[model samples]
Target chain A: MGAGLTLRLRNELSEIRRLTAALDAFAEDEAIPSDVAMRMALVLDELLTNTIEYGYPDEVPGEIGIEAKRDGDMLMISVTDDARPFDPRKAPRPDLEQSVEDRRVGGLGLHLINTMADVDYARINGRNLVTLRLLVTSDGDGDPVAVAT
Target chain B: MSDAGNQVQATIGSEWVDDVLVLKPSGRVDSNNAGSAEAMILGQVDGGAQRIVLDMAELDYVSSAGLRVLLVTAKRLRQTGGRMALCQLRPNVHEVLEVSGFLAILTVCDGREAAIGEVTKT
Candidate 1:
């Protein structure tokens, strides 16, 4: 594993295409398992989509960066945004038990990332940084098992 | 050709499978195109589509934005006394819906026939 890939993105809806391509390439290069890779891509999509939608107010033309790396048995993803100081870590989980009429889309995205990975968030020097630790090729334990590419 | 990869695309092929409106969405649905996708599906509901089956056999990707389309459509159908079912979801898509707890509210079937059956049942 060399230097991981980073994507420089704008706070635009179309930027999701570039973000998806970057995640696909990162998953392919890292030899990540299919299921884990799928979750990774979708969760990363949720992150970028939320940022692009709510991060920039008054058309701030926000600059966002995403870096994907393999750290031991974990595939680490860091998303940094020069937007508002919202921390995804503090987001409340939506009631999954709610009925159809009661369900709301307010917090489903954060609920998803929490379900899929170990998440960390911080506001460093005006940028919101969210770090996600995703498991890779684990044998149900914390240990990494060999997976053929 | 480079611009091709930068553009977001998703296909929603609509057909009537015997009084049941079937919409097949393929490719990716993200923030870039979720609103249009929502309209494409909601159009049927507004046009008096009583029973709709979302044939998701070809859909490969959906983010939270895409899920919002389904959720809103589902809520609309419920309000209008219409019915909808989803079938042929790829494993990843299935997992995403399940994680969002949509499987409990919306109908999910193993195949198109079953989905059609679910929406048509009075």
Candidate 2:
């Protein structure tokens, strides 16, 4: 499933939900674990929120595109946004050891994305591309299996 | 858009068994509308509502901003020796609370009566 939406916060969230729901449905139909589905959704949400907040911080009109596909036993979710060339994967990971009060609030979302999914990123032709891959398997005690594309 | 205009709706119910405040919220809660929800709950707390029950049955979604409101409200009520409880959480919202480790700190109930009973007993 895939969709492109404007960068407005309010409208973008709805679009994010819609795209996630579609991905969830696909996962369910393929008997993917609910936790995996939810995790994938969170990764998508974080990436899209980052794009809306920082990718277009100056309110320049932009577009965010989300695409999800099953490749082997893994679910690959990609989010692309057109703004200044910023690659999230290159950003330094937040220091989780610090106390919440002392920790910076902004970078936690990126940390969550990195920790939860196999995150990859690149800047291609002035657009930021982020791909998150999740290996799907049984709820417990199974080898990581990749879904065929 | 301004954060203040975020959509938030609240429904208050008076419980007969205990004079606790039961609030039901619907729509999205983000930085924009979190203040409204926080203000509503804080107002009830100030109005002598020692025991409060939040019926999240209709609450479809909440962001970090919304979570902050709940945390601050819980802390404030705790300072005054009051109690707050949440009930009937939708699956998605429940997942969020669980993932954030807030389920450990917050009193969650299975139903409205249980939530009321919990707050009153505290």
Candidate 3:
């Protein structure tokens, strides 16, 4: 498997299916575990869905970019979109343990992404950029490289 | 139509057995079609079907958008004195539910028979 892969898709919800398939083939070639790959897919899917669904003001033509690479046993992933300058990392955490009646439906996506992966976000040059890193090794015995925003 | 993203277009099937409503949602449920999944389930709830069972044996993937649908549907059913049970989650979907602490709140069974029993039990 190559050390890096870049994917560009239009800012549309339909693009997520393509994204997941590419991720699946990459994970298979790289020999990443199914569980780990699913986690990675989950976080990225949530973030990208948010960007595609709510990022733009209308059906304006735009693009989102994803770059994933393996650094040692860690998987480094970054997603960039030229939508609104929103920072997902700073989003408020949802109450996970709240009673079902009191719980809200929509906020869990960001919460799940934050819980499953180490994420950092930045708005640079009028773009929304989010970076995520995951430990792909089963032993879970490596120090995570800090991503500077 | 095939999606460039390799996601199968989501499809939802429903059946009624006795007093329970059973939903079979196949393919990926993400932002693209979670609304359809939610609408199907909530529509049953709105139609006064109390006991609900989701047969997820063929469900290959689920994202946070999908999870939200399940949570919201479960909550809505509970408010109306209805019960919802899920069965046959794929490994990936199971893991997502587990990591999100959904196992604690949702009634999940090992198979369709168990799910039907759980939801239909007195």
Candidate 4:
């Protein structure tokens, strides 16, 4: 597994894509389905976008390290960011059932991430670590198709 | 950021064929400078280029900010009883539009000719 990505919001978007592609390549090597790989990419993009937007809003440079490994049937994608320790699990989930006008905008990113992946959160050594586990199945039979990330 | 030195570029070309206004856009549109792109296209609408056909054949990527501008443009055109169509979207951008539900709302065509035909037929 490779180590960190220096946190610069401007270039983080492309880095997220790069990391996702690397993980997808790994998944393909393991014979993971194409559909599942695409979903994982979308989830990772939304999560990284959130970290760039909210995690370090002040634009203070930080580092985001993405590590991926296969654990049984699940592909674990962990993102570690050295920003202010804020647990996304504690953040209020958006009310998806509500009308768009009534619903809040900011929480949708986290809500999508939680709904799409098996999310685990922790604050380790002054860094926020978010682990997202996606089940790789030949047959698509897990969670419902989430709102676009 | 100065708009002049910015790398983001947008060109809007309009032509009327059978009462349909076709607007072709080329280059990137992102957070850095979607304002000019928005203004150029929306300005055409303001200048009586109704029933607009947006040829996104050359467009590479569009960020959320760019998407927002498109949404506003669509809403405005809808209110005025004018139509807007997007044609020949790149694969990556098509995915973004699909995910955002813009595919459901916007009229997407296979090519510029098809888009023009659709707008004129309606």
lDDT of 1 by residue, A1-149 (tens): 74778889888767777778877788778777777888888788888877877777765677999888988778888999998887777788888898888899657887788898898999898899999998887333212345999
Q: Runs in model 2 with CA error above 4 Å? A: A1-35, A84-115, A137-149, B1-17, B26-36, B46-48, B57-65, B88-92, B110-114
Candidate 2, true inter-chain contacts retained = 0.00
Which residue pairs show collisions in model 1?
none
Residue-wise lDDT of candidate 2 within A45-78, one digit each (tens)?
Answer: 7677666656665635667776677766788777
Docking tier of model 2: it is: incorrect
Model 4, B1-122: lDDT tens digits are 22234434456556777667776666546544556778877887788767888888777555555675677788777667777888988765676666555677678998888888777774
Instruction: Answer with 2 or 3, whichever has the higher TM-score.
Output: 3
- DockQ of candidate 4 is 0.11
- lDDT (Cα, tens digit) per residue for candidate 1, span B2-113: 2223544457999998899999998877666777788788877898998999988888777787888998998898899989999988877888888889999889999999
In candidate 3 the C-alpha lDDT for residue A70 amounts to: 81
Clashes counted in candidate 4 amount to 1
What is the Cα-based lDDT of residue A112 in candidate 2?
54
lDDT (Cα, tens digit) per residue for candidate 3, span B1-122: 22234443469888989888888999889887777777777888999989989999878788888898998898888889999999988777887787777887889999898999998788
| lDDT against the true structure, each candidate | 0.82, 0.67, 0.83, 0.65
Instruction: Give the distance in Å from residue A89's predicted Cα in candidate 3 to where it truly belongs.
Output: 1.6
Residue A35 CA displacement from its true place in model 1, Å: 1.5
* lDDT ranking, best first: 3, 1, 2, 4
i-RMS values of the candidates, in order? 4.9, 5.8, 4.5, 6.5
